[model samples]
Target: MMWLAVGAGAALGAWLRWGLSVWLNPVSSWLPLGTWLANLGGGYLMGLAMGAVLAHPHWSAETRLFIMTGFLGGLTTFSTFSSEVLTHLLKGNWVAATGMILLHVCGSVMLTLLGFWQAQQWWGRA
Candidate 1:
């Protein structure tokens, strides 16, 4: 059952990643919108899930395993982020490369905090 959950979550994550890539392709030239969005969204969800699970001690370990290890691990594309940054640098787009790194790192962190706070407000109240 645990393995099944992991497999399902990973598959879902992969599909979501692919779908986002495809959907964002037309706007790929829009200064790293897709990757930034993906990273921020993933980070936020990760923070929310982590906070929710930790706050709820009764939540099953399988839930954490599936979300953190399977879904988030599969969904967050560090390699792609790195590649995109490198591509920008290699293409002599130093501004874009720097912006991408800073935006991804800082934006992800901020969004994650926002997610945790929202989750706290929502689940903590419950």
Candidate 2:
């Protein structure tokens, strides 16, 4: 059952990632905005889910696995991020590479913190 849940969550996450990429592909020809959005969104969701899970200890291990492992594992694309950065570096676009690195790392962390804070507020936690 746990495996089933994880598989289902992974499938859903992968579909969502693909849909977002297809939707954003035409909008930006040079940049990988789709991957950025997916990673940031996945990070935010992971943070939110983690907050809720921490507050509510009754959440099953399977639930955590399905979310943190299955869903986020499929949604976030670290390899693609690395590849994009490497491409920029190889092309001598130091500024772009640094910018992307800072943006992805800092933006994702900030969004995750925001999600965690929102979850805490929703749960009436200080």
Candidate 3:
């Protein structure tokens, strides 16, 4: 069951990543918008789900496994992030490459924290 859940989640995540990449391919200019958006959104959603689960003690281990290990692990693409950064550097866009790295790292972290805080507040009142 766990393996099945993981497999399903991974497939879904890969599909989502591909879809987003295709959608953002056209407007890709200086920054790699697709990867940035994916990481930030994934981080936020993961934080929100984690916060909800932590706030609500009724959540099961299976739920955590599904969301954290399955969905989130599948959704976030650090490998792609690294590759994109390296591509930018290889293409001699050092400034843009550095900005991308900093923006994604800092923005994702901040957004994730914000999501967690928001979820905590929202779930705490429940």
Predicted structure with the largest lDDT when compared to the true one: 2
- Per-residue alpha-carbon lDDT of candidate 1 for residues 1-126, written as tens digits (9 for 90 to 100): 899778888888777877777778468673556666778888999889877986797888788878877787777778888998898888899998898888889988998898888888878833
Could you give candidate 2's per-residue lDDT for residues 1-126 as a string of tens digits? 899778878888888888888888568644688888998999899889878987888989898889988888789878888998899899998988898898788888898898898889887563
Scanning candidate 3 in windows of ten residues, the lowest lDDT window is 25-34
How do the candidates rank by TM-score, highest first?
3, 2, 1
TM-score of every candidate = 0.88, 0.89, 0.90
lDDT per residue as tens, model 3, 45-75 = 8879878987887987777777767777777
Which lDDT value does model 1 have at 25?
Answer: 48
C-alpha lDDT of candidate 1 relative to the true structure: 0.80
lDDT of each: 0.80, 0.84, 0.80
Give the lDDT of residue 90 in candidate 3. 92
